[model samples]
Target: MRISLMSTTLAQGVIDWSRDGHVLTAEQKKFYEREGYIVIRNVVPQYELDRYQKRFMEICKMKGVAQSMTVMRDMTIARSEYVPGEKAIMKVQDFGDDPILFDYCKYPAIVDTVKDLIGTPNSNLLAMHTMLINKPPDSGSLTSRHPMHQDLQYFPFRPADFICCSWTAMEKITRANGCLVVVPRTHKGPLLPHEYPKWEGGVNPMYHGIQSYDPKMPRLHVEMEAGDTVFFHPLLIHGSGTNRTNGFRKAISCHYANDDLCRYVDIDKNQEFTANEILDVARKRMKKYGMSEEEAKAVQIDFADIWRLRARAVNGVRQHL
Candidate 1:
């Protein structure tokens, strides 16, 4: 919550060599500065691009993960469809054990682009989650668009939106297939929240206590081509629409954060951020509200639970079953 921004260790390498045009051209840089996001077309070469996508699909099939039109890859989708007896999604964190996927993350182009945006050559892969949207020719599942919200809404530790994501297009992403849309310049303000979506019953993606945006905010849909990547501020609000086209939409989302000021926390709970190293920040916030110790502890425990669940979800390694 109130932690300092991630350190400049990673940022140092970036400033030494990067320019605005390598990933984001001058015009695009201007666009990003004004709007909060830029579409970096072909940040990844076609060859390396194909390698990662192919490896992920094989891992999915070997693990026996069901192919569904509606779910994204990564632990979130795997965990959502997880049966107690079955294997889960292939975690990219464990990619060290495999050569192909491991090499994919270390690709120079990817790292350079990250260095350009985050000002850090030492950037670590915060998360590597893939999404596969399969739709039939005529009939397919229809889900609501992801509510507009900032990535920083989930992780408040990073100083000012010093985060980046690259969603590689495995297949062509068209408007009919639900490409991502983002609000320009929305990242400059504090995060706004949306109503938590109740997927089936009450089980759904945790909103991380984010409230929806003001009704009058401006918005845009980011229509991207296959093999292109879009980068944005972590605080920028973004989401995609449902796939209405006949074909499937497949993409891998790679998240990165500044090494300094970044900490692993449960995004679902009301995490506390104290200015100093005080153990009683929670108690103090509660005291200001006249809450008894028991009530404070209850909130802390709930916050801790959400934090822990998300932690398990974050760095755990899941390979193909």
Candidate 2:
């Protein structure tokens, strides 16, 4: 593995897990500290998973949507003739408007565990980003394969350690179905520079990646069954392979933050920040929906504004961020 000096140095130190109400065992804490992630088997119940699965299909089958949820297409396959309409859907955002998804996000099993990892006694926990990813199979698109990168790149929040993600498998995940692949201990290193992938056919610039991925990093494929959840650090270098199977690989994930510890960074000065990339995406979507340039200009909002609307206090008290 090509280990940077900073990562190597951090790996040699121990992570402090001191907290008011931690639920992780010593071993689990150690694993997260050393590897920047942990998979808690069956953290979500099967009944809950079934509910979400059913709701997801219902949404997919709906004909006309009137603004409650945003359905995003796989940019890589959006222009392709092979995938059309809802079949091109890569993710469903702002689904929290649905009671089922909202309740699931606040489910004690998920909240308590997240609190253990990145919570504080005096503050609340916020669900910063929520989405249901559907990695379609047999589509000749790069959407199924995410480039190696850190989650923090897209987030404007400070103190990277205060942010984390809980990704739950809604169905069986395997290497053929694009299971998550992560590089251990990468979270301990500083946030590296990121740029949009320069693929010939084009890519979803919203999903930024490292300038160049080191092939020798200690990468691991994380396969899981339904109800299994993986909690990972925001800075962990991770991505997935293309789905070679005949079915879609489905997963629901929410990025969380310790509201007390996280605050938005000044994006205006940080021209390279990924928040700028996300804003560009929003503008493109607006234009794609047939909005005139003037119309888009009049209503355009930055990524932070969009995230504020999507965020919800899942535990303790609500925080204004």
What TM-score does candidate 1 reach? 0.62
TM-scores for every predicted model:
0.62, 0.85
Candidate 1 residue-wise lDDT, 78-195, digit = tens: 4355433112332332343345654544556665665566644444434332233232222232342454566654453444444666666656777787778787877766645445
Q: Which lDDT tens digits does candidate 2 get at residues 1-321?
A: 111122222222223564224567767777786799999999888899889877777777654443547777777566667654446777887676777776667877878777777754444888888888888884675556888898877666566777779999998999989999999999988777887777664665466778877878879999999989999998899988888998888899988887765666644333356776667667766888899888877885866676777778876766655
Model 2, backbone clash pairs (residues 3+ apart or across chains), number: 0
Best by TM-score: 2
- Kindly report which residue pairs in candidate 2 clash with one another: none
Residue 164, candidate 2: C-alpha displacement in angstroms: 1.0
Q: Which 10-residue span in candidate 2 carries the lowest summed lDDT?
A: 1-10
Q: How far is candidate 2 from the true structure (C-alpha RMSD, Å)?
A: 5.5
Question: Candidate 2: TM-score?
Answer: 0.85
RMSD of each: 10.0, 5.5
Shift in Å, residue 117, candidate 1: 1.4
> Candidates' lDDT values, in order?
0.50, 0.75
